[model samples]
Target: MTTAGGRPPRRLRADARDNRDQLLAAARAEFTEQGTHASLNKIAQRAGVGAGTLYRHFPTLAALLAALIGDDVDALCATGRDLMTHPDPDEALAVWLHAVAVHATAMRGLVATQMAALRDRRTAGALAACHDAIRAAGVALLDRAHHHGSAPAHVDIADLLTLVNAAAWASEQAPDDAALLARLLALITAGLRA
Candidate 1:
C-alpha cells in the first residue's frame, strides 16, 4: 500500500512478520528491565531470533525504541488534542505536561533517547516521526495556554518539554521518591506562573 508520501510500504512475509513481532516483544521486555541501553543480542536471543534478524527489523536502538513506544506517543498526542477543549487552558497544559512526564517515566530512560532524537535529524525515521508528533502536541497545548493569556507570551514549547524531560530524568534518578515527579511539575508550573 502506498503511504501518504506516495511510497509503497514494505510488506513482510508471514514468517518475517512473526519474527518482527517476537523481536519487538523481547525488546520491550529488555528495555523495560535495562532501559534504552539494553543488549540487542539479548533481545534477539530472547525472541528466539538471530542478531541478524533483529538488525533487519530494527537497525538501531532508536528505531527499536520508536517502534516500542509509538503507540504511547500517539495516545499522548490524542490526550493533548482532547485537552484543547478544556475549560481552563493553564490547567489543561499542566495536566498534559504531567501526562507527558508520566509517559517518559513509565519507559524508564526514554526521555534521554527522545531528547536526542529531537536534536538529531539523522535518527531512525520512526523516531523522528514520533518526536514530530510530540512536538506538535506540545505546541498545540502551549498555543491554547498562550491564547488564553494563562501562559506568558514568551513561553516556549521546547523549553517546557525540556523541563518536563529533565524532571522525568530526575525522578528516574530518585526512584524511591514516589512524589518527585509531581513535586517537580509543581515547581515547574510555579516558575511558569512567575
Candidate 2:
C-alpha cells in the first residue's frame, strides 16, 4: 500500500514490528500513569527492550506522543460515529463532546502535551491531521444539532471544541472530582443549546 504522497509503506521485519508495538504499549501505559514527563528508560524497561531499541523505534518523545494521541483521536472519532445513530441530535452532540473532554484529560498533563504537540513544528503536521479528523466528527454532530433546532445556527465546530478543551483543562485541575467535571460539561452543553 502507498501513502497519500504515493510512497510505498515501509514494511518492518516481524521482530522490528513486535519491538515497535511493545514500545508503543509501554509508552502508553507509562504516560497514562506518570504523565508526559515519564522516563523513557522506564518505558524501555517496561517493554523489556533496550533503551537503544526504544530510541530506534521512536527517536523523540514528540514522535511517541504523536502516535499515542493519534490512536486516541481515532477512537474519539469512532465514538462520534457511534453517537450519530442516536434519536436525538442534541443528545448525540452532548455525549460526543463529553467524550472528547474525557479523552483530552485522560492522563495527567495530557492536555499540555496535546497543546505542545500542536505547536511543535516537528509534530504539528501529524497532530493537526488527528485534530482535523476530530473536527470533522465534531462538525457532523454540530450540524445535526443545528438542523434539529437544538443548537444555535451561529455556533460552529471550533466554538464547541474550544469549550470542550476548557472543560478538559478544568477536569485536569480537579481530577478526583468527577462531579465537578460533569457539572462543567453540563453547563457547556446547556450553553451550546439554542
Each model's RMSD to truth, in Å? 1.9, 2.5
Cα deviation of 1 in candidate 1 (Å)? 4.8
What ranges in model 2 sit over 4 Å off? 4-7, 115-122
Model 2, global lDDT: 0.82
Candidate 2's residue-wise lDDT over 140-169, tens digit each? Answer: 989989997479898988777877788778
- The model with the greatest lDDT is 1
- After the best TM-score superposition of candidate 1, give how far the Cα of residue 102 lies from its true spot, in angstroms: 1.4
Candidate 1 structure quality by residue, lDDT tens digits, 1-194: 79899999978999999998999899888877888668999999999999999998888887888888888899999999999999988888899999888887765675455655568687567788887898899899889888883689898998898899889889899989989989999999878777
Indicate the TM-score of model 2: 0.84
Candidate 1 at 29: error in angstroms?
0.9
- Which consecutive 10 residues in model 2 have the weakest lDDT in total? 111-120
TM-score of each: 0.92, 0.84
